[model samples]
Target: MTVRTTARWALLGALALVVTACGGTSGSGGAAAASERQVQVSATFAQGGGGPAYTYDTALVPAGATVEVTSAAADGGTTTTLRVSGLQPNRTYGAHAHTKPCTPAAGADAGPHYQFRPDPVSPSVDPAFANPQNEIWLDVTTDASGAGEATSTVPWTFPPDRRAASVVLHEKATATHAGHAGTAGARPACVTVGF
Candidate 1:
């Protein structure tokens, strides 16, 4: 993928547009003051299959476009919003809060969706523990300008010792049946976050 960063001004302008369009800001002050705790991460998808079986690359999220993930505290409620931007226009992408950080290390790659009570097995396909209520799932559909946002909320908060460390973008919507219910598709990019 063509991994790189756009100018800071571009980001500021985009953020301004995001706040206004989404009505996420209040008065002169904005989204910065509307939450309790939050984690935001930015990353660029690596071109080609880096790992995780498949990579969306240019075919889905587009190379080099910024991938952002924001996880916020429930704010005395059962809700955590996850947002993404700088993606391919008019396409849907599935994303989840991961148990590990995004890395190229052979053994430390984003490991599984962060489950409230981890499924005893890997690649958890079980509907009971892999459902949206047990894990954070943000499936986003971008606009004409390759910017979008999605939110996910659960009744519980991340365990202090082991919280979601990353957010991985995928090629498809989260499934709802016999297959991996939370598995979006081949992970294309991940945003390393701390929550």
Candidate 2:
């Protein structure tokens, strides 16, 4: 592996350790509840086939790339953090929480963005339903080293009846225009994250 790749893995490992360390249950009032509100996952992109984390476009996402997701619900809201490495350098990737797990066939398998309030119409372009406040948007811009991170905090938590199951990375940054709000380009990669 290249030096950059090695360093990225090391960083991911450290982040995993930090998340684990902070996830311990205290067995006291509200302490265990607090720990239960957090979720963290780290996975390497599957190369030859589909897996928990898969790269649909090898040219952009590449094999062996790593994705780390951290979601925490507290203070009457939910905050999600997404970190990615070993992707194409100097590019912005649009990512959002999806309604289903990823599959080998197509990015569509991951389903639509997990909206706190379901949009009445399909392909929701209306800002009222597609805005960041209604859905988790994590658009990350990679640097020269092909590493990037993004965080999104929404005012509401994922309801028990419906929760996000994956994170889909798109080809470009998300569009916020009136007619194209929440529209990102083709999906290049996906990571199945339980949140």
Candidate 3:
């Protein structure tokens, strides 16, 4: 081949190589971006209060988003799933996420509900005055071994300014709301939710 023709061909090859290296595609197609972050939590309850021993595992949907405690187990026990939605920020929600396989003690269920606190005051009591942000209420059930599952869609915003905290299960059952501290019962197991 002539020198000039050879040079032109080599340049064309080099240009093609560059284009391929730059991820030139045949059509307008690209990988999809990842969605919001998801957080998963796993908790195990030992033989506390001389009661049952069990393990619980659950997946929390978007980071800082509302979660519906979907499924759970107590020594392989199961229960009816509960739906608790729209969690509030700067407040504590009461939840009983586990309901079954059967702990050692008869009443040794997942104990009481969880209390996310510092919420607003109850409107029913003080008609005009507004209460502080308090806790989320959940509808949950358990099985024979005191194991169950609960889910909620949290409406609360996870504060960016403060440090991350956790949800704790108490040794005793809690009130519908976390009415009294130290009285909600002893903290059995705790699991951190956000980063």
Each model's lDDT: 0.70, 0.90, 0.34
- Candidate 1 per-residue lDDT over residues 1-195, each given as its tens digit: 233344666788899899786774354245445445766655555554442222345566555676655566754433555555567778888888888877654213788899988999777988988898888888888898888888888877776687877777888788978666787878767666777
| Candidate with the larger TM-score of 1 and 3 | 1
lDDT of 2 by residue, 1-195 (tens): 699999999999999888766654333545747544888989998754658898888998998999999999986799999999999999999999999998877788999999999999988888889989999999999999999999999999877879999999999999998878899999989988889
Number of clashing pairs, model 1?
A: 1
Candidate 2 backbone clash number: 0
Predicted model with the maximum TM-score: 2
lDDT of 1: 0.70
Worst 10 residues of 2 by lDDT: 23-32
* Per-residue C-alpha lDDT of model 3 across residues 1-195, encoded as one tens digit per residue: 699899999999999898886664532233211112234544334332321222232221112222222223222222222332222222232343322223433323433322233225432223121122223223334433333445544334333353223344444434433335323344333333332
Ranking by TM-score: 2, 1, 3
Candidate order, lDDT descending = 2, 1, 3
Best by lDDT: 2
- Regions of model 2 farther than 4 Å from truth: 1-28, 31-36, 48-50
